[model samples]
Target: MHLMSALLISLLLVSGCKSTTTRTGPIAVGPGVTQSQSPSPEAKRYTYNSDIYLDVAIPVFNPGFPIDDDTGHVDYQELDELDIWPQLRRAEAKRFAVETKQALAKTKAFGSVSVVPNANTSADLYVLGTILHSDSEFIRLEVTVVDSSGEPIDTEDFEHQVSESFFRDAMNQDKDPYEPVFVEVADYVYELLTDMSEQQKQQLKNTTLVRYAHYYAPDAFAGYLSQQLESKRGTQFYKYELNAMPAENDPMLQRIEVLRNQDMLFVDRLQDHFAVFQHTTNGPYRKWQRETLPEAVRAREARSERNTKAVIGALGFIAALALGNNSTSTSTAVAKTAGALGSAWLLKDAYQANENLRVASAVIDEMGQGLDLTLSPQVMEFNEQEVELTGTAAEQYEQWKAHLRKMYQLESSAN
Candidate 1:
């Protein structure tokens, strides 16, 4: 009886038959985890030397959508079957890029920060961002920076684990829970810019301008810039040099500058469109994030507890089976009986935990349905000519660039 009582008590505790509080344990640290890192990031604003201020261009980010196993593309039927949305991910890629642009702009540490529809824009600096994984509970991004000379400046992966508490605070509701990640990226970029010499900035600016000029008249402007393939930090980029300066009064140069200014103005309008998309998506997206985060946490906890209970229960049954079959004493029989009954209870509790996990997951699925599930076409115009920019954002951007090239060819032929 004494042995039975002790065994029963331990099994009850392991199965969580009485306690309602969730168990906590040590978290596994990642390979990149470093101790004593900068604590809790905040986006700070500062004005730096005007000479080092360089034009920045950010393209819409890669969505990193999961592909269908058979089709090799995102299949809406598969998404519906799994209750997942890749369309939201496509939209999120743009929103994340725009948000980072805003963070950099807030710092006032750089010049002319703008988000272009695509990567065709030539600028003194380019910030490319890719989304790896994003959810209400966590997000991961890979950011790369490059100069106009196509020289890789820096790259880093930033990740954040968000909790329901981040949204629970009343004052923080209107703010991004993931601001720290963006702020950290902006800080690092500003730090890099601070280290650049004025000469380097001017060279990068000129290189970009010349490259843009080459788009219009390659024969005339391409000779002014020279490029050599070089490897830095295990990445290859073309290092550009100014072979010679184009005459200041060159007719082609002046016309190219005018065309470039017009392109920038168009990009500014596109940037505003991106801003509006983020604003409209934000309210509903944040609400869903806040509502579903706790459920996600709960589902994880339930799985953990279920696994723990399953292992313990399996052991309890094995021990009881052995005691019953191998023992000849009556007291051992009593203990065996108790163990068998306790094991049954333990397995039942484990099953309950699994059910809890499913319920929580279902709740998240419903909440996810709140956001509209697709990106849309956009209208773009230049020189009083308008076209419907169709397909993915990247495809649409290529269409716009092609239109620009056609326009340039017409002008050049006439001249």
Candidate 2:
């Protein structure tokens, strides 16, 4: 009876019977343990030649205590560094660019990605993203994909949490965390950027906004203006930020600088729009087609320059002849010298005016083409009259006047 009972107990234990007891042991991963290959990633990176972008715009991170602002306090002063916003943006932008390339390369799509400025007026597909909430340790983001005409194509929101200690440790070790952050964030962005739909592409082509900016400064000045774009160190400000400008004693010069900055900003904005436009089949304003205007302007300017030089020479000779002739009356000498000086100044002014006009015309022509605006002098005149005349308009009008002045000079010279 005892043996029978014992056998029955053993059988019950071996028969996979349910038990209220718990068991604990080390989990092992070894050969014969049929280890499962991690599931293939949803986004298989491959090289792609398709136009794609990864633009990153960072908000000012003031280092105030987290309690001061509803979102932890950040020091406002540190944000004021001249290059802070751009530097952050560059870092973020480059990270996205690299990661996008890597992801695309994985799929053998393309090995590289082109990075460009974001413009309001155009982008094949405008990717509306924000550095929603950022702290010293973590950043939260919301990325939305939209067609050029401001319609949502697709949307994605990502929350990235990182350990503050890890970052500090990496910093202490002189290690860069940029790659890690970039890889992660860019992966998220790429997942959205590449998975664009056919409908989105069509919308991008049909609705891309046309935009332009006209900078009427010398090349060197324009270059400087380009470099001084506003970065968010503390507040949003640019190198040429008119608000931070020194109180001016000379209103005219101040006004000129202000105008220059405004124009430069407009240029920057157009550039942003173009960057967005390039991703689409119908790119922002057909820049490739419009590039010919500069050559045309140069050719015309060269001829005007030659004429100006001749007129200047003639005036100089007239002055010299009057000065050398001892028999000439005092009145003759004075009159001749005045006339030469006046003519030389006038010609120089005219040449300068013509150059300005040419630039204005070129800019207008480009804008007209880019925006698909039908441009007739009559139309321009009408537009000029309809709008509230502001400083920029006045400046443009001056350029138009300069063109008229050039025409007058040509007609006068011909006669």
Candidate 3:
């Protein structure tokens, strides 16, 4: 009778224990897909030889939110006060800028393609982008092109969904998940540049060259090539204006070109640091996601199990006490045995839940430390003036432009 009672108690305890089995679904492979068709022979024949220097600025991460009826605006507040999601979104914006630069270079439409920290950097043309949405499944960007004077030349919206094949390719590390979107953006830019008239191309080149001259020797070129005001119709339009042209072979212009190249070299060095920043953050970020996501899910499951076991254990103890007070001695003994076993299992589960919590805390701490180590302030210098490059490129450019205007005013007054 004692042996049977013991066996029954053991069975009850075993039945109460939570299952540890975890089910992971099978991996799904996508069907193969072909690349887009190439351009026609006639289309391929069109090419330009203009020494156009292009600059791509880091995109703004614009999180969408409904403002009013049928209207939406970017939740800049969310990005400014960042959490993990916002941090990831910011990183995606940087990646988009880098990819755009790479794509532009591949097209060979420009003499050189460079990624600048802000729009204030001098170039024949600039590509600015804002990331409307970006995730593992899809990305959307609003891209615009402008000359050195900030005159809008072209604008387009790019939206791409990650197809099954593209996702599979990214999973296999065969290609970047965002490469398709970058390619489309590049193709559009190429088309825009190719479609431009010779007069437009020459005008952009002249604007860029004149801006350089004005930057280095404002006294000599400021009156001839003013970027202050223009008149269109009856209204005065504020823009970069060229009232007179400089000789193509002027010695002063050649000297300015050399100085500009030296500045570009300095900017290139800064870009190298940005590359390091990207590398350090990207690797640790991926590792953190891989380690913590599954652990978080498992932790929740463990807590659920712990709750179940505690409730069952408490019920058993109450029933055992009742039986002991009113039933036969044998029944009382069996009930006590069952209650003790249940209590023991409950204690074990509680310990496991606590352990999971500790592990989760450690993972978070480690991720925080990694982010702290990698994140640093990026400072850029132009004309020996240091400016901390933060916030949107457009914002930075405005600040820089304001500073330039003040300096010019001060110099003009002194003269």
Candidate 4:
């Protein structure tokens, strides 16, 4: 009978060890066994005879923190003015975009991969992405591909959990742990391009050039560059007609080409500013990750310990009740002691979990302050016009495009 009671206690304790706490709120790490490296799928690659320029737009930062149901979209303006945290998030998004561009460029999938400030920038393809969440242990992104006309081509969502081994490799290499995520994104884009029909590829090439010309000299190409739809019984139908293309040697087209080359020079110069921003933020960003990783690990372990103790306490109580009538006074006393000891462990676990969470939060807050020190307004000048390049690449591009339009108009009028 004593042996049976001992076995039962051992079984209960073993079962208790298997259970874990379900984390709630922002403290939750995604469910998975950490992989040393992600599996590489054999991706198909296509070689295009003609050049294809791809523009990667600066990603939007979406803080995945839950808010009240009554609160719709987050007012970023309010947050931007008041919160340093949001500013850090914005910096994270910019860094993410730059890394993605670099990844795409490395793939050699396109003739050129440029990090355009906005969607309005002309390219054969546009990659728009949003940073849903970013932290030391995990990163999530949603990406969409569209043409110059805002027509959706493809969309994909990606999430990656940074394993301890992977993190260590990244630290040793002096690289971002999330670099694999960007590589996957580039692969997805490459796959999409490879699967396109020849006709679709031609359409993409023509549309990109037409849009570039139209932006600078819309009046010259209006009739040749308009979207039209086919109608059946006075209703529009599936059939659509794209703009007609001008001769390759049209004088206005040739002029637009020269103008675009000059515009690209300006765009290339703008990249230096982005390079500076990246250099300024990269150190603090990586330092924050390296410093916070241990805290995250400790917090996870604390939660696990708390859960184990709670389960053991509950099981001990059950065992004590089951053995109450059959057991000797000595056995009863031992069972009671086990239950009491389990309860004490539960209290200790709770305290440790709370302390771990507090420490993790403090570490993140300190990192945010370090990032704030690196923040500064960036401005660039072109043709006597000063443009603020402090916001997302898209915002800065919009300002640059406006300046280009004015310059082009002035030159056209002068001629």
Tens-digit per-residue lDDT, 1-415, candidate 3: 9999999999888877745555586545567744444432332233655564444444333333323443465455653332224455555656567778778777777766666556656777777888775534446888877666656666789887654444233343434556678888888887878777777777777777787778767877887676666544443535786676788787667666766665666456556655676566766655554445455455556668777777776777777777777877886788777887777778677778767756654554455342421324446554577776444444544454555555545655675
> CA lDDT, every prediction?
0.79, 0.40, 0.62, 0.67
Model 2 off-target regions past 4 Å? 1-44, 47-118, 165-185, 197-203, 209-415
Q: In terms of lDDT, which candidate is stronger, 1 or 4? A: 1
Cα-based lDDT at residue 139, candidate 2: 45
lDDT of 2 by residue, 1-415 (tens): 9999999999899765657555686677777776444442464344444653322221112212223254565544544321123233323332333333343334432222323333222234443445443322334545554433333445555564444344233232433222344355456555565676645444343222111111222331232222244434233332221112123453333433444343344334333333343243123322322333343345346557757765775777676675657547787778777767776776776677566655644443344332311112222222123222223322433444344334433543575
Ten residues in sequence with the least summed lDDT for candidate 4? 232-241
> Could you tell me every candidate's TM-score relative to the true structure?
0.74, 0.28, 0.53, 0.66
List, residue by residue over 109-205, the lDDT tens digit for candidate 4. 6765666555556677778887666657678888877655546667789998777665565435577788789889988887787777767877777
Give each model's clash number. Answer: 0, 35, 0, 3
Q: Residue by residue across 1-415, what tens digits does model 1's lDDT show? A: 9999999999989889557766586655899866654264553557686656798998878776567889798777755544345656666777788888988988887779988766778788888888876666778889998888888888999998886688766777798888778887888788888889888888887788889888778888878988899999888877887877788788888888877876776677677667778888898778778887898788778889899988888999999999988988999999998988888888899999989988876776666554432336877777788887777555666777777778778888997
Better of 1 and 2 by lDDT: 1
Ranking of models by lDDT: 1, 4, 3, 2
Off by over 4 Å in 4: 1-84, 165-173, 226-241, 300-352, 370-396
How well does candidate 1 match the true structure in TM-score terms?
Answer: 0.74
lDDT for position 154 in model 3: 68
- Of 3 and 4, the candidate ranking higher by TM-score: 4
Report how far residue 267 has shifted in candidate 1, in Å: 1.1
